[model samples]
Target chain A: MAVDTKKCVGCADCVVACQTENNVPHGFCRDWIVENVKGTYPSLDMKFQSERCNQCENAPCVRCCPTGASHIVEGGIVLVTHDDCIGCGACVEACPYDARYIHPQGYVDKCTFCIQRVDKGQNPACVDVCPTYCLHFGDLDDPNSDVSKALKNRSWYVLAPEAGTEPQLYYLR
Target chain B: MKEELMVSGKHIAEIYPVLHLWHWEISLYLFLGGLAGGILFFAAYFFIIGKEKEMSTTVKWATFIAPLALMIGLSSLLYDLHHKLYFWRLFTTVRFTSPMSWGAWTLLIIFPLSIIWVASFMKDMFPNWNWKWKYLNQFESFVIKYRLPFAWILMFLSIILAVYTGILLSAFNARPLWNVSILGPLFLVSGFSTGLATSMWLSKNDAERRILSRIDIFFILTELFLIIHLFMGFMAGTAVKLEAFRLFMGGSFTISFWIFVVLLGLIFPVTLEILELNGYHVPKWVPPLLILFGGLMFRFVMVDAGQITRFLY
Candidate 1:
C-alpha cells in the first residue's frame, strides 16, 4: 500500500470505511490519520498521513507469537487466526509500531489489509473509500501496478526505519 | 520559553490507546519461573555433590517447591491468556528464533526434570506413605539409580529456564527496558540470589543457614553490580534507551524501582544478612522473607514499567 501524504485531507473517511468493512469493534479502528504540523504559526506545514498496520516483512508480532496464530498469508498480509490465538499479548508487546491490540472478543486484532477484498481482486476498504484517491493499493512486484508507478515517480519514506521492521506501507511525498 | 501553542518545528507524536495487555499475572509468572529454576538448580547441585542426606529437609522442601512453583507460574501465565484452553497450540511447533517458543520448550523439559528431582527425595520425605505406595518406592529407586546423570540434566534445564525467563522479555525489542543482553545474566543472578534466600529460610541447621546466608551475600552483591551496569548500559545507549533508564531515575517507575526493588529488595536484605553474619542476631525469617518479597516486587515493577517504555517518537 502506498499513501500520497500531500493529498490526504484528514477526512477520516477511510477510517470509517475500514471499520465498517471489517466490523471493527466500537470505539476501535483498523486505520487512523496522523496529523503533524511543522514550522511556526503563520508559515506552517501540515502533514496528514493515514496510518495502520505496516505489514512488516520481518514482523515481530508473527515472530513472537507462541501459538503461531499471528502469521503471514498470501500477498504478505499479516493476520491473526482467532481460533489459534491464546491472546497472551506477547505479539501485541513485540510489535514495534504498536499496530495490534486485544479485541473485546478475546483475541489479538489488527489491520488485515482487507484480506477478503484483496483475495477477491479488490482494493482494501480504506483505499476504496479515500475521497482524494490518496491511498493506492497494488502489487509492488508488478511493474504495471499503480503502487509500483507511484513508487517509481515519487520519493517516499517508511516510518521508524531504525525499527528494522521493513514495513511495506510507504508514504509518498 | 513559557509561550503557548505557537512554536512548531516538526512535532511528531504517536496515537495509541493505553495498553494494559499484561498485568500482575504476568509479573507473578516471571517471578515464580525464576524462583523455581533457582531452587531446582541449587537442589540438584547439592545432590550432585553428595550433600543431599545431610540437608534432607531442605532438599525435600526445595525439590518439592520447585515443581510446585513452576506449576503455579505456568498456571498464572495460562490464566492471563485470552484463550486459555488453546495454550496447547504453543507446543505444536518449535521456532528457534522466538523466545516464547524457547520458553515453551524449556517448560516442557522443566516440569519433567522437576518431577524427577523431587522424586529423588520422595522416599526420604514420607516413609509411612512411601511404604504403602510401591510406585513411589519404584520411582525413588529408579531416580536414585540414575541420580548423578539426572542431577546434571536437572542443573542444565534449570539454568536454561533461568536464562530463558530473562531472554523472554529481552526479545521484545520494542520495549527498551527489556531489550538488553545483560538481562539474561541479571535474571540468572537474581534467581540464584532468591534461591539462596529460600534455602536460608528452609535450612534446618545453623551451619547450613550460615553458609547459605554467606553465599547469598555474593549473589546480592553481584545483583547490585548487574543492576548498576544495567542502568549504565541503558544510559550509554540511544535516546529511547535513556528514556527507559529514566524509569529508575526520576520517571514514573522511580519510586517502585528504588524503594521496592533497590532499597527493600537488595540493600536492606543484604544489610540485614551482613549484620547477621557479623553476629548481630537478626530475625530468623526477616532477611530471607524481605529478599523474596523484594524479588516479587522486582518482577512487578520491571514488567509494568517495561511495557510503558516504547520506541516512539
Candidate 2:
C-alpha cells in the first residue's frame, strides 16, 4: 500500500468509503485521515496523511497471540482469525500502531486492506473511492505492479520504521 | 525585518487511543500467580534440603495455599476473556512466539504439579484421615518416593512461572514500561520477597520468622533498586518511552506509584524489616502485611499505567 499525501485534501472521502464498504461498526473506522500542521501561523504547512494498519512484517500482535488467532496470510497481510481469537486483548496491547480494536461482536478487528475485494480483482475500498487518487495498492514484490512503479518513480517512507515492524504501508511524497 | 510568526495549529489527540482492556482482574491474576509460584519454590526448596521438619508451618500451609492461589488466579484470567467459551482453543496448538501460548501450557503443568506437591505432604497434613484409608498410604508413599526429583523440577517450573508473569507483560513491545528486559528479574525478586513475607505471617517459630524477614529485606531493597532503574532506563529512552516514565514521575499514575508501590510496598516494609532485624521488635504482622498489600498495589499501578502510553500518532 502507498499513499500520496501531496494529493490529499483531507475531505475524508476514503474514510467514509472504507467504513461503508467494510461494514465498520458505529463509532469505529477501519481507516482515518491524520492532518499534521507544521510551522508558524503565516508560514504554516499542513500535511494530510491517511492512517491505518501498517501490515507489519514482524507484527508484534502476531508474535504475542496465544492461540495463533492473529497471523499473517498470503500477500503479507496481517489478519485476525475471529473464530480463534479468545479476545484476551493481548494483541490489542501488542499493537504499537493502535490500529486494532475489540469489535462489538467479541473479536479483535482491524483493516484487512479489503481482502474480499482484493481477492476479486478490485482495489481496496479506500483506494477505489479516493477522490484525488492519492491511495495506491498493488504488490510491491511485483516489479511491474503500480505500487512498485510508484515507489521507484517517487521518494517514499514508512511510518515508524525505527520500530522495526517492517510495515508494508508506504507514504509517497 | 524578519517576522517571527507564532506557531499555532490544531494538535489532534484523537490518534492517541486510551484502551481499558486488562484491568484490576488481570492485575490480581499476575499478583496471585507470582505469589503462588514463589510459595511453592521456597517450600519445595526447603523440603528438598531436609529442613521440612523444622519448618512445618511454612511447608504445611504453603502446600495447600500454593495450589489454591493458582486456582483463583487462573479463574480470574478465564473470567477476563471476552470469548470465555473459546478458552479451550488455546490448547489446540503451540506457538513459541506467543508468551500467552507458553503461559497457558505453563499453567497446565503447574496445576498438576501443584496437586502432586500438596499430596506428597498429605501424611503429615491429615494424620488421622490417612489412617482411615490404607490405599491412601500407598498413594502417599508413591508421591514421597518421587519427592526429590519433583522438588528439582517444581523449583525449575516455579521460577519459570514467576518470571512468566513478568514476561507476559514485557512481551508487549507496545507498552514502554512493560517492554523492558529488567521486568523479568524484577518480578522474580518481588515474587520471592512476597513469598517470604507470606511465610513470615504463617510461621509461628521466631527463628523461622526472623530468617524469612531477614531474607525479605534483601529482596525488598533489590526490588526498590530495580524499580528506580526501570524508570531511569525509560527516561533515557526515546520520546515515546519517556511518556511511559511520565506516568510515574508526574502523570496521572504518579501518586499511585509513589505512595502505593514505592512507599508502602518497598520502603515501608524494608524499614520495618530492618528495624526488627536490629532488635527493635516491631509487631510481626505489620511488615509482612505491608509487603503483601504493597505487592497488590504495584500490579494495579503497572497494568493501568502501561496501557495509557502509546507510540503511534
Candidate 3:
C-alpha cells in the first residue's frame, strides 16, 4: 500500500475502515495518522501520514511471535490469527510504527489489508472507504499495478525502514 | 538563550536522549525481574522436592517478597515517563518492533501469572487469614492439583521474563552496551543464581540448602559461558558502542563488574558449590550471600555506567 500525502486530507477514514474490518477493539488502534504538526502561530504544515502494518519483507513481528500467530502469508500480507495467539503482545510492541494493537480479546491485531476480502478478490475495506484515494493497495511485484506504478514515480518513505521491517506500505511525500 | 532553548531548535532530536533512558529502565527491570525470578525459582525447587520443612520460614518470605519487590521495581519504570497513561498504552498495543512493547506485554502477562502461581504456596503461609470463606478450606486441594503445572509455568515465565528483559536491551541497534545476543542467556543464568542465593539465605533447612547449593553449581557454570560471550560480543561491537566494554574494563564501573558480578556472582558461588559437591558442605552463608550480592552489583554497575554514555549522535 502506498499513501499519497497530497491526496490525504487527514480524514482518517482509512484508519476506521482497517479497525472495523479487522475487528480492532476500542482503545486499540491498528492504524494511525502521525500528525506531524510543524510551525507555530501561522505557517503550519500539519502532515498526516497514514501508518499501519507495513507487512514488511523483513518483518520483526513474525520473528518475535512465540506462537507463530503472526506471520507473512502470500500476497505480501503480514497476517495474525487471534485464535492461535496467547495475547503475548510481542507483535504489538515489535512494530516500530506502532501499527499493531492488543485487541480486547487479548491478541495482537493489525491491518491485514482486509485479507479476507482480498482473498475473495475484493479490494481492501480501507482502500475502498478512503475518501481522498490516498491509500493505494496492489501488487508491488507487478510493475504495472497501481501501487508499483505510483511507487515508481513518487518520492516515498516507510516508517522505521532502518529497523529491518521492510514494510510493504510506503508514503508518497 | 532561554527562548532559543524553549523553542524547537535542534534540541528535539538532541534532548536528554530518551532512548538511552528507555534502555536503562529496561536494563534495571531485567536485573530486578531476573533477581525476582531467580529467587522464586529457588523456592519452587524446594517445593518440587518436598523439602518444605527443610526450608525455613525465610524461604516463604523470599518467595513472597521478591515478586512483590519486583512488582514495585518494575512499576518505578512507568513513573519515569512524561505521561503515565502512555505507559499503560503499552499494554493496549503489541508492536514487535519495540522490545519495550514486548517487555510490557510479557511483564503484564507474566506478572499476574506469577502472582497466581506464587499465591498457591502463599495462601497456606497465611494461616491467620479469615477462615470464613467456604473455599478457604479446599485451598489445599486446589493448590495440590495445580501446583506442579503452575510451578512449571512460573519457571517458564521466570526464564522468559528474565532473559527477554536482557533481549529487550540488546534488541536496540543504537546502544552498544545492550546489543549482545548473549545478554538473554546470561541474564537467565544470573537470575537463577540470584534466586537460589535469596532462597538459601531465607531458608532454614540444612537439607534444602544442600540441594539449592547443588543447583547453584549448575547455573553458575552456565553463567560463566554467558558472561564470556557477552564480553566477546561487546569487544566485537563498533567502537562507539564498545563503550559498554570500556565501562566494565577501563571506567569506574570496572570494579563492580569484576568483583561483584564476576567474582561474587559467578566465580565464588561456583567455588562454594564445588566444595559442597566434593567433601565438605560449605558454610551455609557462603553461596547465597555471594549470589545475591553479585546480582545486585551487576545491576548497580549497569545503571551507573549507562548513565555515563557519551553518544556520538
Question: After superposing candidate 1, which stretches have Cα over 4 Å from the reference?
Answer: B1-15, B131-133
lDDT per residue as tens, model 1, B1-313: 2222322111112225434568999888888888888888888887788878776545667667788888999989888988777788888888777888878899998898788777666556766555357886676788789989988988898888888888889999888899999998888888878877887788778877887788889999999999999988988989889889887889888898899888999999999988998999888899989899988998888888888888764
Which is the leading candidate under DockQ? Answer: 2
lDDT tens digits by residue: candidate 1, A65-96: 88788999867899999998987888888887
Which 10-residue window in model 3 chain A sums to the lowest lDDT?
A88-97
Cα displacement (angstroms), candidate 1, residue B160, comes to 1.2
Residue B1's lDDT within candidate 1 is: 25
Residue B307 of model 1, lDDT score: 82
| TM-scores, all models, native as reference | 0.94, 0.93, 0.58
lDDT of 3 by residue, B56-121 (tens): 443466777666857876776754443334344455557666555676676777677656555656
Off by over 4 Å in 3: A1-173, B1-28, B45-61, B122-129, B135-141, B237-243, B272-283, B303-313
DockQ of each: 0.44, 0.52, 0.04
Runs in model 2 lying further than 4 Å from the true structure: B1-16, B131-137
List the lowest-lDDT window of 10 residues for candidate 3 chain B.
B2-11
Evaluate all candidate structures by whole-model CA lDDT and list the values in order. 0.83, 0.84, 0.67
